[model samples]
Target: MMKKPAMQKSKQWNIKGAVHLAGIFHFLHSCGSGCLVPFLTLYFRHLGLTATMTGIIMASKHLLALVWRPISSVLARQYDKRRTVIVGSLLSSALVVLLLLLFPSAGIKAESGRCNTSQPSADPTDGSDFTTLESINIPSQSNANVYSVNHKTIITEQPDELSSTYTPTLVNSSSNWSIRAIRSLRNLEEQQEEAPHTEFLGSLKVMDAQQQMFFLVLFVIVLWEFMAAPLEWTADDGLYEYLDFVDATGRHKGVKVWKQLGAAVGTGMVGILVTKLYCRTGTVTEFYSYTALMILTAPTAALFPLYLRKRERATSGGFKALQLVYGNSQALLCAITVVLTGMATSAVSDFLLWQMQDHNAMEIHMGISLALAYLSQAGFAPLAGRLARFLKYHGWLMVLAVISLSLQCLYYSFLWGPWAVVPAQMLAGFSTGALWWSVTSQCEDIATPGTEVTLIRLFEALSLELGAGLGSLMVGFVVQKFGLKILFQGISVILALWSIALAVLKWKIPRQRRINYSRLLAADTSEVSESESDQEKDWLETAMEDARQGNKWKMDKF
Candidate 1:
C-alpha cells in the first residue's frame, strides 16, 4: 500500500516535469517560424512579383498541404518517427531560409534600381518637389520594369536606401502625377534620343532578372511547404500523445499558451530588426533570426517522446479517421465551418500587409501591430478553456470565431493608416488564440477516442487547407481588379453572412460527441453490414481494454 502511494507520487512528478519540458520545445518551435512567415507577402512584393503572382505562390502552401501533410502523418504513424519527422522538418525550414538569404535584401524597403520607389509626399498646391524629384531618377538608361508615376518616374538612388529587398508599388492614372509626368516624359525622350538601343537592352536585362527572381522565389516556397508540412501536425500530435500518457490533456491549452508567448517574442524581435534597419541592412534580418531559431529547436524535436499504443483493436488498419467525417453530419459541419472561416481569416493573414503598404505603413507599424497581436493571443489563450465552459457547447466557440473573423475583415476594410493595424490586430490575437483554441479543441472533443494520428482529425485540417488555398487564390484576383480596400469590404460582408449560415446549420445538425468506431474500414464508402458489425466490437471497448493493459503494464514502453 505504501509502495503504491509512493509510485503515484513519483508518476505525478514525472508528468509535471515532462509537460514543462515539452512546453520549452513548443516555445522554441513557434519562435522559429514566427520571425518570417508573417512578412512573406511583403518579401514577395519586394522581389517585384505582381500581387496575383504572389497570391498564387502563397496559396500553394495550403493546396500542397493536402498531399504532403497526409503523407507525413502516415509515415510518422507507421515508423513511429514523429520525432524524426519534426527534426527533419525544422532543419528543412532552416535550409529554406538560408537559400532565401542568398538573395540580397534590405528589410522591406524597395531597392534603388527597382522602378517601385516610394514617391515623396508633395503639397498638391506646390507639386514642384514631386515633379523635380521624379525627373532625377528617370533612368538616364532604359531599364524599364514597366512602373511609372502616372507613366512618369520617381527617384532615390542612395545605395544604403535602395537595397535589393525593397518594395516597388504600382502607380495608376489616379496618382498625383502632373508636372512630374511631363518633366519625366521630356527627360525620357532626350535620354532615348541619345541611346535608344542601349536603353532597350538594359530594359530586357532588368525584365529578365525580375523574371528569374520571380520563378526562383516561387520554386523555393513550393519546396519549403512540402518539406515543412509535417512539422506542426507531427509535433502537435506527439504533444497530444504525451498528454494522454499522463492523463493531463486538460492542461494542453494552458501549456500551448507558451507557443503564443514565444511567437510574440520572435515576431517582435524581427519586426524591430526589420523596421529599424529598413535602410541600413543589406541582408534580410528575419531570415537570419528564423534560421537560428529553427536550428535551435531541431535537436529538441528529434528527442521528443511519443506514445503509440499497440493496434489491439479489430478495426485497426483502414482510414477510420476518414469514415468519421463522411458518416457523421456534425463532424462534416465542423469541417465546413473550419474551411469557410479559414478563407475569411486569410484576408487578414495574407493580404492585410498589402493594404498597410498602400497606407504607407512603415516596418515599425507592421512589426509592433503583429507583435502585440501575438501577445494578445498569449494573454487570452488560458481563458479559452473557461470560456468554452460558459459558452456551453464547443460549437458556440466556432460561432464566436466566425464572428471575430468577420469583425476583423470589417476593421481592415476601413483602415486609415498603419497605426490602426496595431489595434485591429489585437482582435486577431483572440481569433487565433482563444478562437483558434476553440476551433481545434472543439474538434478534438468531437473525435472518437484513440483515432488521433495528427491532433485533430485529418479531414478537419484538409478542409482548412482547402479553404485557405481557395481564398488566397481568389483573393489575389480581387486585389488585382478591385484593389485591397474593396476586397476587404467585400470579404467582410460575405463572411458576416457566412457566420450566420454556420450558426444556423450548427443549430440544426446535432454534434457528434464520439463517432462510431466502425469495423468496416475497407468499406469506408459503404455502410457497415449488420452481419459484419455483429462479428466485431466497437473500438472504445478495445480502447478500454488497452487502458487496463497499459495501467497493468505501466506504459507498454516503446
Candidate 2:
C-alpha cells in the first residue's frame, strides 16, 4: 500500500504534470481556434464583404463546428488522447500563425492611405480633374481581386510576353455603375450626418473591451480548465446581453460582432479548464479546499494523477475496472445537470437585465452583477462543503440543489414583471455556486482510479458547453415567444423532473459500503500476494469505491 506521505507526493506530481500538458494545449487552442471564431466576421468585413455575406459565412462556420463536434467525440473515444491533443493543438496553432503571416493587414488598401469605398470622386467634366488616356492593350486578370480606385475600378494581370504587363477596366459605358456609385455616396453622406446624435452606450464599449481581455486572460491561465470555461461562459453572457440590447439599434453592428467573439473565447476557455481539472484531480477543487472532502483528499488526490504512465494503463486499465453502465441513464443525468445549471444562471442574468430598466444605470448593473456573482462563488463554497457532509449521496445532493433552485427560480419568474427578475438574483447566485459543487464532487465518484482525471473532466467540459449553448438559445427563444415568465416556469419544471429521475436512480444503485481507509489499506496491503494485474485492478476498484462512499472516517478513524 502507498504510504500517506508517498501518496501525497504522487498526487502532487500528477497535478503538476496534468497542469503542464493541459496548459500547453490550452494556450495553443486559445490563440488558434479560439481566436479565429471571434475575428472571422471582422476579417470578412475587412475584405469589403457585406453584412449579409459576413453573417452567412459565420453561420456556415458555426454549422461546420457543430457538425464536427460528434466527430471530435468519436476521435477522442477511438484514438489515443495524447495523439489527438498533440495533433489538434499543433494544427490549430499553425493555421492561425499562417493566416496572420500571409495576410498581415486586416483591412483594405487604397492608392491614398485614407480611402472610402463609399465616396465618389470630384467632378471630372473639366480637364483639371480628368486625364485623357490612350487606348492601350491590357493584360487579363481575375475580377475577384479588384477594387475601385478614384473614378475607376480595376484588376491587375500579368502578360505572357514580359515587358509591361498590368491592365485596368474602367466602366464608363452606360453610367449605370455611376448611378449606383452616386446613390452609395448619398447614403454615406447621410450616415456621416447621423453619426453624432445616436445613443452612446457605455455598457457596450465596456462589454467589447471585456471580450478582448478574455482572450488574453485565457492564454495566461490556460493551466486550469475550470478557470477558463466558467469565467468565459459568465463573461460571454455579459457580452451577449449588451449585444442583444444594441441589436435594437443598427449602427453598432461592428461592435456587436467583437462582443460575441469575446464571449466565444471566454466560454471556450472555461470548457478547456473543466476537462483538464477533471483529468488531474479526482476532486474538482483540487486547486482549492472550499469543499471539506477536497481538503481531506488534497494530500493525495491533488498529486496522484500527474505522472505520465504507459498509454495502455492510462486508457485500458481504468476502463476495465470502472465498467460504468454508460447508456441512456448516464445521458439523462448529464442532460438534467446541464439544463438545471443553465436555467439557474440564465435566470440570474435575466433578473439583472430587468433591474437595469434605465439606460443610465446599465454600468452600475454590470459592476454589481459581476461583483456579487464572483463573491457568491467564493462565499458559498464552504456552505456547499457543509451540505455535502449532510447529504452523502452525490445523486441526492445534486437533486436537492436543483429542485430548490428550480422552485425558487420559478417563483421569481412569475412574481411580477421586470421587477421580479431582480429578487431572483439570489437564487442565481446560490444555483450557480451549487452547480460547481455538485458536478465536480459527483465527478469524484464517477472517475476511475488510474484513469486520467482528464477524461472525466472532458465530460464536464462537454456538459458545461452544451448547457451554455442550449441555455442561451432556449432563454432567447422563450423570452421572445412566451415571455420571460414562461421561460422561467419551463426551466423550473425541467429541473424538478430531472432531479426526481436522478434521485430514483441513486436509490436503485444501493452501493456496497466499505470500511474506513486505514482498515481498507491494511487489507489491501495484506492482499498484495495477488497477481500484478489483479493488484492494479484491486487498487482502482477500492479508490473509486472510497470516493463513492465519501467515507472520510477511513483516514481519521485510523
Candidate 3:
C-alpha cells in the first residue's frame, strides 16, 4: 500500500513539471512572434510597395500559411511528431529570417543631403496631410522608390523603424526619393490638385523596378511563414495533448495568459529599444531582435512535451477534420463572423502603424500602443470563458465583438496625433478575444469527442488566415484608392451592417443542435406496418447498435 501511494506522488510531480514546461515554452514562443509580426505591413510599405500590393502579398502568404497549419496539426496528433517537429519548425523559420536579412534590400538609394529641403513646403491646412518624414533622421529616397507607393502627391520618406516586419519607423532615409517623386507627380496636370489630397499615398507604375523588388522580398517572407507553420497549430496541439494526458487541462488558460503577457513584454521592449537607439540603425536593430528572438524560441520548443496517443490514421479521418460538423445555421454564421473578424484584425495589424506614422507618431509610440493591445489580450483571455458562460450561447458576445471592432476601426479615422493610438487600442482585447472565444465555444460544444483538437485548429486557421487574407486584399486596395481614413471608416460601416445582420439572424433562428444523421436514419417505422418478428427485432437492434457506435450514417434494417 505504501509503495502505491509513493508511486502516485512521483507521477504527480512529473505531470506538474510537464505543465510548467509547456507554459514556459509558449511564453517564449509568443515573445518571438510579437517582436516582428505586428509591424510587418509597415516594413513592406517602406520598401515602396503600395497598400494594395502589400495586401496581395499578405493574402497569398496567409493562404500558404493556412495550408501548412492544417497539415502540421494533423501530423502532430496523428504521428505524435509535435515535439520534434515544433522545434524543427522554429529553427527552420529562424533560418529563413536569417536568409531574409542576408538578401540585400533593393532600390533604396540612400544619399547624403536631407530629403531636398529645397522643395516647396507642404500645405498646412490638411491635418491629415503630414509628411511621412519631418526633420528626424529621414532617409533620402530615390524618385523610383517614392513613385512605387500608390500615386499620391505629397511625397514623404518614412522613418527607419518606416516601417519591423516596421520598428514602419522614426528613422528617415537620408535619400531624396520623396522630393523627386513630388516634382514628378506635380508635372502631371490631371494629378496636380489631387496630390495633396492623396498626400502620402502616390501611385507608381506597376512595371517599375521598385515595384518588382517588393514582389521579390514578399516571396522570401512567404517562405518564412510556410516554415513557421508547424510552430503555430502544432505547438498548441501538442501542449493540449500533454495537458489531457496529465489531467491538467485547466492550466491551458494560464498558459495563454503567459503567452499574451510575453508578447506584450516583447513588443514593449522593441519600442523602448527603438527609442534608445539612433534612427539610422533602428530598423536593422529590429531585424536583429526578430531573428534573435526566434532563435531563442527554438530551444524552448525542443523542450516542449507532446503526448502522442496510439491511433489509426486514414484518409477519412483527415477529410473529417476539415469538414464542418456543426448545425448549418450556427456553424455557417460563426464562420462568417470569424472571417469578418479576420478582416478587422488584418486591417489593424497591417495599417494601424502606418496611420500612426501618417499622424507623426514616434516609433516608440507605435511599439507601446501595440504592446498595450497585447496586454489587453492577456487581461481579457482569462475572463473570456466567464463572459461566454454568462451570455448562455446566444452569440450576443459575438455581435458585441463586431460592434466593438468596428468602433475601434472607426476611431482610427479621427486620430489627430500619435497619442491617439493609446485610447484606440487599449480595449482592443475585448473585440478580438471575445469574438474568438464565442466562435471557439461553438466549435467546442459540437465537436465530436476525439476530434476536438483538429476541429479547433481548423476554425482557428479560417479566422487567422482566410478571413485575414481576404480582409488584407480589401483594406490594401481601399487605402490605396481613398487614403487611410476613408478606408477605415468604410470597414467600420461594413462591420456595423454585419453585426446588425448577425443580431437579426440570432433573433429569428432558434438554436438547434448539430443533426445526427446516423441516429435519425436508424429510427424504426416497422411498428406502424405490423408486429415485429424475432428476426426483425434483431436487425433493428444491430442497426441501432451500429449507429450508436458511430458507424456509417446510412442504416439498413434488412
Candidate 4:
C-alpha cells in the first residue's frame, strides 16, 4: 500500500514536470514567432513591396495553415505523438534557419544620375520669336546641374558650359500644327538628349537581381509556413494532454497559471528585445538571428515532455472519433461559438496597429499598446481561470468573455488618444485570456469519455485557425473597402449577434457532466443485452400489476 502511494506521488511529480516543460516550449516558440512574424510586412515594405502585396503574402500563411491543420490532425492520430512533436519542432527550426538565410536584408540601392537634368523650354509657337529667347538662368541653391534650352534648335550645355553661347536655327511650324503635336515633339527632344547619361546599366542589372532575390526569399518563407503548420497543432495537442493530467490531479489551474506566466514573460521579452535590438541597431539581420536562435531552442524544450512517464490515452482512430464528438448538437454549437470568438479576436488583433496609426500614435506608443495588450492577457488569464471555477459554469465564463470583447471593440472604435488605448487594451486582454481558457476547459467537458483529448483539442485548434484566417483575410479586405471605423462597427454588431446565438444555445442545450466510464463498466459484470431485455419485461409486468391493484382499490372505495 505504501509502495502504491509512493508510485502515485512519483507519477504526479512527473506530470508536473511535463507541464512545466510544455510551458517552457510555449515560451520559446512564442518568443520566436511572436516577436518577428508580425514585422514581416514591414520588412517587405522595406523591400519596396506595396501594402496590398505584403497583405497577400502575410494572409497566405494563415490560409495555408487553415488547410494544413486538418492534415496535421490526421498525422497526429496516425503517428507516435512524441515523434511527431520532435519532427515538427526540428522541421520548424530548420525552416527558420532557411528563412533567415534567404531573407533580403540588403534592400535595393537607389541609382545615382537617374534624375532628368534638362530644363523645360517654352514653346516658340506661343507668340514668342526665336530672337527674344534669351538664356534664362534659374538660380538654385543646391549643387545640382541645371540646363537651359533654345526653342528652334536642340542646344545641350553642361553645367560647367553655362557661359557658352549658341545661335538658334529657326524652323517655321505650319498653322495646322496642333499644340499636342508641338508638346510631343518637345518631350521627344528631352528624352533623346538625356537618354544616354540617365541610363546606368550596372545599377539596372543590380536592381533586377534584387527584385528576383526578394521574390525567391518570399517563396521560401511561404514554404516554411506550410511546414510549420503541423508543429502548431502538435504543440497544442500536447498542452491539452498535459492539462488532462494536471486536471486529474486537481492542479489544472496551476498548469494554466504557468502557461500564462510563460506567455507573459515571453511577450514582454519580445517588446524589450524589439526596442533594444531592432530599434537601436536598425539591422534586420540581427533581429532575424535572434529569432532563429529562439526557434531552435524550442525543440530542445519540447524534448523534456518525452522524458515524462505519463502517456496519452490511445485514440479510437479515424473519422469515428471526430463524428462521436461533433455529432452532438451541443458540441456543434460550442464549435460555432469558438469560431465567432476567433473571428472577433483575430480581426481586432490584425487591425490594432492600423487603428493606432490612424490616431497618429508614435511607434513607441504603438509598441507600448501592444505590450500592454499582451501583458494584460498574461495577467488576466489565471484570474479568468479562477473566475470560471468560481462561476462553476464555463459557458458563463464564455459569456463574460464575449461581453468583454464587445466592450473592447467599442473602446477601440472611439479612441481619444494613443495613451488612452493602453488602458483599454486590458479589456481586450481579459476577453482573449478568458475566451482561450474557457474554450479549452469547455472542450474537455464536452468531449466523449474514452475519446482521445488530442482529437478534441485538434477540433478546437482548427476552429480557431480557420476563424482567425478567414477573419484576418476578410477583415483586411473589408477595411480596405469600408475604412477602419466602419469595420469596427460592423465587427461589433456581428459579435453581438454571436453572443445572442451562444446565449440561445446555452439555454436550449443541457450541460454535459463528465462521466467515469471505467467505473461504470467495472460495476456491471453481466452481459448488457441479456440483462436489458429481462429488466424491460419485469418493469412492464410491475407497471401492469400496479394498475390492476389501483383499479381494485378504486372499486372497493366506491
Candidate 5:
C-alpha cells in the first residue's frame, strides 16, 4: 500500500494532470472553431451562394443537433466519455479536412465545361480541306518527286499533284486559330475577373460552392454557440447589452472603430501567456488562474467551456470527465432558463417599442443593443474563460448578473433615454462576460452520474440553439399580440426568478463543496475496466508506484 504522503502526492499530480489536460484541450478547440465566426459569410459569398441559402444551411446544424443530442447523450451515458469525445472531434475534423480538400476539385469541375482550349482538327485529303489555290505550279508526271522551274528552286510534290515550274505557296487553315486563341484568352481573362474576387477572402475562395455552403453552416452554428444561443438561454444577454453600453460610452469616435485593433493586441498578449504558462506549469492551478483572468473580461472568457469541451476531446478523449461533472438535469434547467428569459426579454423590448408606434425608435434601440451584443461576444470571449476560472460557481455569478441587469433595465425603463444605456453597458459587460464563463464552468462542475461530456455539451449546444430559435419566433408572436410594457414586465419577472433559482442551487452547492466526486467517480471502476487504454493504465500504475515509493503524493481533487 502507498504511504500517506505518497498518496497525497499522487492525488495532487492526478488533479494537476487532469486540469492541465482540460485547459489545453479547451484552448485549441476554441481557436479552431471560433476563428470562423467573423469570416463565414464572406466565405459563402466567395462561392457565389446566396444569403438565404447560407442561413438555411447554417441553421441545419441545429437541426442536425436535434438528432445528435439525444443520441450523443444516450451514448455518452452508456459508453466512455472519452470515446464519445473522440468520435465527435474526429467527425468534425474529418468533415473540415474533407471540405478543405474537396473545395478546389469542385471549383475546377464547376469551371470545366465552361472553358476549353482545343479546336477541331482538319484532314488535308478532304475536299473541304483543299481551298482553291490561285497561284500554283504544274510539274511533269515523271518529275513529280523533284520539280524545277525557271528562276525557281527545286521542289518535291506528291505524284497525284505533279507541277512543273513549281512555285512555293502557303495555305491558311480554314479556321482562324489565332482569333480563336485570342477569344479563348479573352474568356479566360474574363473568368479571372469574374471569379468572385476571392483574393481578399484568402484560401476560402479556392473552396467549392458546397464546401462554402458547409463552411457557412458550420460557422453559423459556431456563432450561435458563442453568441445568440448562450445568451438567450442564460441571464447573460442583459449583461452583454450593459457592457456594450460601457465600452461604447467609454470610447470616443476613433476608439470604437479601432476597438478590434486594441482587442488584437490584447489577444496576442493573452495567447503568448497561455502558450508560455501551459508549457511550463502544465498543471490545473496554472490553467485555472490564467483562464480566470480571461473569463472575468467577458467575450473570449465566455467561451471557456466550449474551449474545454472541444480540446479535452481532441487531446485526451476525456469526455467522461466532463460528463461526470455536468449532467442532463443541469443542462435541462439551463435550457429552460435560456428559453424563458430570451423570450421574455425580446418580447418585452419589442412591445415597448410598439407601444410608442415608433418603429424607427425601436430600431435605434435595437441597433445599439445589437451592436453592443456583438461587441461583448466577439471582443471579450477569451476574457470570459479566465473569469469562469476565478468565479467558480454560477450561483454567485447569477447574483452579480441579476444586480447588473436590474440596474441596466431601471436605467432604460426610467432613468435614461436610449442613450442612457451607455453607462449601464459596463454593468452588462461585467455580467455577460462573467455569466458566460460561470455557467459553462458550473455545467462542467455539476455533471450527474453516468453522463458523458459530449452529451452534456451537445445538450448545452442544442438548448442554446433551440432556445434562441424559439425565443425569436415566440417573441415575434407575443409582440404582435401584446403591448411592450407587458413583455418587459414578463421578462423582468422571469430573469428575477432565474436569479433566485440559481442562488438556491448555489446555496446547496457552495465553492467548498463544488466538486461532485460521487458523480465523477461513480463508474470509475467500470470505466477503468472497459475503456481505459493499456497505456493510460500503465501511466496510472506508474504514478501509483511512484507514490508508494515516496516519490509523489496522492492527487484526487482537480
Candidate 6:
C-alpha cells in the first residue's frame, strides 16, 4: 500500500515537471521568434523593396503556413511530436542562417558625376528642345584617359586593333543623348565599354543581382517559416493535451502566463538590441545574425519534450479522417467572430510599423511600439483568462474582444503621433489575447471528445492563418490605393459591424447549458454501491437454501 502511494506521488511529480518543461519550451521558442518577425517588413523596406512587394512577401509567408499546417499536423502524428519539434527547430535555424547569407546587403551604387549643358538652339524646322552634353567628367576615370568631344557627343579613344571589336546593337534615334543614346553610343567603341563604362555596367549588374538575391532570400524565409510551423502546433497542442491529462482546468492561463512573460522579455530585448545596434551601425544585419544565434538555442528547449510521455488518449497514428461536428447558431457566430477578430488584429500587425515609419518615427520608436504591444499582450493574457471565468459564457467574452479590437482600430486610425500608438496597442493586446484564449476554450468545449487537438489545429489554420493572409493582401492593396489612414478607418468600420453582429447573435442565441460534475459523480457512486449490496444478499440466500435442502435429504434417508 505504501509503495502504491509512493508511486502515485512520483507520477504526479513527473507530470508537473513535464508541464513546467513545456512552458519553458514555449518561452524559449517565443523569445527567439519575437525578435525578428515583428520587424520583417521594415527589414524588407530597408532592402529597397516597395510596399506592395513587401506585402506580397509577407502574405506569402502566411499562405505557405496555411497550406503546410495540415501536412505538419499529419507529420506530427506520424512521428513523435518531440522529434518533429526538434527537427523543425533545427531546420528553421539553418534556413535562417542561409537567408541571412543570401540577403542582398550591398545596394546599387550611385552614378558618377557628369556634366549637362542647357539645350542648344532649337532647329527652326522641328522646334523641339534638346539638351547637349558639353563636357563629361567621370569621377572614376583619370585625366590620362583620352576622350574626344564632338558637337554634342563624347567618345572614348581606343586602340586601333580593338576598334573593330563587336558592339552591342542599339535602336536608332535622332534625339539628343538619353538612356537610349547611351545605348547607341556603346556600339562605337568596344574597348572603351570595358574601361570607361565599367561603373555603369557594374551598377546594372548589381541591381540585377540584388533582385535575384531578394527573391532567393524570400524563398528561404518561406521555407524556414514552413519548417517552423510544426513547433507552434506542438507547443499549443502539447500544452492542451498535457493539461487534459493532468485534469487542470486552468491550463490556458497557467501556460500562457509563462509564454507571455517570455514574449515580453524577448520583445523588449529585441527593441533594445535593434535600437542600439541600428542606431550605431545603421543596419539590421547584426540584428539578424543575433536572431539566428538565438534561434539555434531553441532546439535545446525543444529537446525537453522528448522526456514527455505520450498520453494514451492523445491523437495519434496516420491522419485520421475528421468527422464534421457542427455546433449551434451561437457556435457559428463565435466562429465568425474569431475569424473577423483575427483579420482585424492581423491587419494592424502587418501595417502598424509602416504607419509609424510614415509618421517619421525613429527606429527606437518603432521598437518601443512593438515592445509595448507585446508587453501589454503579455500582461492581459492572464487577465483575459480570469475574465472568461467571470463571464462564464464564451460569447460574451467574444463580444468583449470585438469591442476591444474596434476601439484599438479607431485609435490607430486617428493616431497623430508616435507615443499615441502605445495605448492603442494596449487595447489590441487585450483584444487579441482574450479572443484567442476564449475561442480556444470554446472550441475545446464544442469539439467532439478525443478530437479537441485536431479541431484546434484546424481552427488555427483556417481562422488565424487564412484570415491573416487575406488581411495582409487586402491591407497592402488598400494602403497602396487608399492610403494608411483610410485603411485603418476601413478596418475600424468592419470591426464595428462585426461587433454589432456578434451582439445581436448573442442576444438571439440562448446560453449553453453547463455540466454539473459533482452531482453526476454522486449518482454514479450510489448506483455502484447499491448493485454490490444486492449481489451479496442474493448469495447469502442461496447458501441458506442449500443447507436446508441437505438437512431434508438426511431426514428422508433415516
Q: Which candidate is the best by TM-score?
A: 3
Candidate 5: how many backbone clashes? 64
Write down the lDDT of every candidate, Cα atoms only.
0.67, 0.40, 0.67, 0.56, 0.39, 0.59
- Per residue, candidate 2 scores C-alpha lDDT tens digits across 433-503 of 56656655544444444332333434444444444444544564455457556666787887778778767
* Error in Å for residue 264 of model 6: 1.9
Lowest summed lDDT over 10 consecutive residues: which window, candidate 6? 108-117
Off by over 4 Å in 5: 1-335, 342-369, 377-394, 402-420, 446-456, 509-558
Q: Write the per-residue lDDT of candidate 5 for residues 1-558, one digit (tens) a residue.
A: 975654444322233333333334334333333223222333343343433444444345445544454444334433434233433343334234223212321111111122232432364333211122211223234433222121123333334432343333313322343233223333443444467665677456544335554565556455333222222112121222223333321111122223333333333333344334432322122223323432332333232121112222323223564443344445444545544544433333323323322322222343344345335644655565444445543446545665555554444444234444445544555555444445555554444432333433443444345643454455444434563344455556657777787667656642322335544465455433222235345656777787776643344321
What is the lDDT for 13 in model 2? 25
| Shift in Å, residue 227, candidate 4 | 3.1
Order of candidates by TM-score, top first? 3, 1, 6, 4, 2, 5
Check candidate 1 and list the clashing pairs: 109-166, 110-166, 110-167, 111-166, 112-162, 116-168
TM-score of every candidate relative to the true structure: 0.69, 0.40, 0.72, 0.62, 0.34, 0.68
lDDT of 4 by residue, 462-533 (tens): 556767766766776777678778777888887777777788788788755444455345545442344334
Candidate 1 vs candidate 4, TM-score winner: 1
Q: What lDDT, from 0 to 1, does candidate 1 have? A: 0.67
Q: Name the lDDT of candidate 6.
A: 0.59
For candidate 1, lDDT tens digit of each residue in 1-558? 355444444434366666777788888888877788888888877655667877788788888987788677767866677777888888887887568755532123343422323765556543222222212233434534343443354332322223335433433434545534434444444555556566645553333334556667777888888888888777776777678777766656556677877887777778778777755553378788888998998777766656765533234423676676667776677667777777776657788877887787766677678778878877776576567667666577777777776788888988888797766787765565555666575555445667644336454465468877888888888888888988888987887787798889989985544433442343453444443343344545766899899897876664
- Model 3, 232-330: lDDT tens digits are 677776777678776666566566777887788778887778666633553556667777877787777777777667854834544565565434577
**TM-score for candidate 2, residues paired by index:** 0.40
State each model's C-alpha RMSD to the native. 12.8, 19.9, 12.8, 14.4, 24.2, 14.7
Give the 10-residue window scoring lowest on summed lDDT in candidate 2. Answer: 127-136
Model 3, residue 146: C-alpha shift (Å): 13
Could you tally the backbone clashes for each prediction?
6, 20, 35, 0, 64, 0
